[model samples]
Target: MAEENGAAQPQVKMQVLAQFIRDLSFENNVALKGLTGTEMQPEVQVGVNLDAKARSQPNTFEVNAKFKVTSVNKVNGDTLFLCELDYGGIFLIEGVPQEQLHPFLLIECPRLMFPYIRRIISDVTHDGGFPPLNIDNVDFLALYRQEIARRQAAAQAVAN
Candidate 1:
């Protein structure tokens, strides 16, 4: 008997729609404090949430990767708007193979979101009365590979 993919039948194509910021809010330096030490202990808290919207046609979807960042003092309760940004992208991906789509979603989609995310972070930090926060470029490709490897290792270990 043929393997039943059922509702999970793999689609040969995929695509992204216009990934724009649906909503965003930023709070700058809430509290100010004098520095005790020249070395600042910057603590960054990053939260990421994933969302997907299906298009009218099958295999087409828009993905949003939202990132929220809050920086605070390690010793004191001082707050800093290091960065907070919601970035999204609409990708036109179709007629592509399934194996290829994984990387596209994980890497390519995030890549598209990066610029907007960076901008929001920089502006928010600057407006908060601090130097702009320059976030480094992210390598989604490498990350995707690493994640895949880790998952495979875990599965192998479980089987053994």
Candidate 2:
């Protein structure tokens, strides 16, 4: 909140200060053999993980989201290609309550950064000589809930 002309005001703000590719790897396993178009659909596996931690700077955090994709010939299980990407963004948040900080950092920040990461994955796969691999939308809320449950279960096991 700031005073404007001696009047009090309220303000809320959140912003992405920067975004970058922390790491990326693309493997065209059969490039030497060459990728000829195939009639049969290839099987694809994708995995994503997200993490966030406080930065040295005040009210700032670094968020990392990793996406890994692997494709193989369905019939023979031959390697087609593999891609791994680590995408990160820096966020600046203000006026948020202490109790809400964890959820804000984990869920909201990644939600804001996912589109760019998804686009990078699609572009890299397309440039690697296959059709654009479109990633499905992630349910961050569900993932957070699942992680919380897993931790609780692990704690119970350890106590018993």
Among these predictions, the greatest lDDT belongs to: 2
| Candidate models: Cα lDDT each | 0.67, 0.85
Candidate achieving the largest TM-score: 2
What is the per-residue lDDT of model 2 for residues 1-160, given as tens digits with 9 covering 90 to 100? Answer: 2475786543547999999999999998768556566544588898878888889999998989888899888877877899999999999988777778887877888899889988998999899887898888888888778888998999999999
Counting clashing residue pairs in each candidate, in order, gives: 9, 0
Error of 1 at 47 (Å): 5.8
Candidate 1 clashing pairs? 13-95, 14-93, 15-93, 16-90, 16-91, 17-90, 17-91, 19-89, 19-90
Itemize residue pairs with steric clashes in candidate 2.
none
TM-score of each: 0.64, 0.84
